[model samples]
Target: MRRTITKFGSLAAVSMFALALAQPAQAVQAAGATGTTAASSSAFFEFTDGTDTFVFKLTDSAKIQQARNILSGVETENVGVMGKVVKTPAWYNSPWKYQIAPNSVSFFGMAMEVCDASISYVDTHLNEVGGALLPGSTWCPWQSKLTREVTAP
Candidate 1:
């Protein structure tokens, strides 16, 4: 059961979305200019599906700020492109060995993680992520939101 997704307004209305997906390399460089290592500058974002809280890391300074803005109510874009879920050590505080593609972070008004599929479906079908589940390896939790900014462990 998919709900009706809302479309974002013109470009002027969602400037943060554009900024979030901006050049990540440039953002890392900007952080370096300010005396911070790429890893030290990484920001953590927390999203919730009402029952569960998911944490993610954004290495891009621009995306970090954009995520902070979204959580602070400055940006209304509540959806993000989750990219690929890596089978590495969990970047977030989850027991599952999954982490979203940091370089692929971006905001969207409406997105389907794997063409109208739910996150649970993807998790249950993680083995087929890059194959059938998420052919392109992107997971956009449509109902997810930037609930908070957290400190990395």
Candidate 2:
């Protein structure tokens, strides 16, 4: 009787261990080829000046890196407008041109949105300011307007 009981207990323990080992493999098989990949995220920003609207989509890491590189060199320039020279500061230049305001980064998965303030030079005399140019006076110093973040789908 004692021998029989010992054999039964050993068999039970072995069966439990085998069952535990089989579960993970079964799960992996159920997941299949599509289930093993990781999720992707993206980031972007939108701007409106009560007239026109602009949206920037940062969908890739390269784009994010490029934006960061562009923000590092911020400066001003003088451009000709209707035969007249005008001093205009270029926002989003090399450095500090892309101003990431404090506490503006919002994360959604691997993506994040960072509040930023940027500007571009324009020739007002020609009535042709390239792109969606926002005047410096429109945004308040304390108010946060820019959104830079990653998004996921």
Per-candidate TM equals 0.67, 0.25
Question: lDDT tens string, model 2, 1-153?
Answer: 999999999999999999999987887676565565111334444433333332334434544544444334321121100111113322322221232221222221121112112233222321332223323222222222233332321
**Candidate 2 residue spans exceeding 4 A from truth:** 33-153
> Quick one: best TM-score, which candidate?
1
Candidate 2 is scored at a TM of: 0.25
Cα RMSD to the true fold for all candidates:
12.4, 20.0
* lDDT against true structure, model 1: 0.68
lDDT (Cα, 0-100) at 38 in candidate 1: 53
Report every candidate's CA lDDT. 0.68, 0.34
Candidate 1 residue-wise lDDT, 1-153, digit = tens: 123233334444578766776768678789789998655668777776555566777887788878877877788865554656775656465755567777777877886445434545655677887777667777777766667788875
Q: TM-score of predicted model 1? A: 0.67
How many Å off is the CA of 140 in candidate 2? 46
Candidate 2, lDDT over the whole model: 0.34
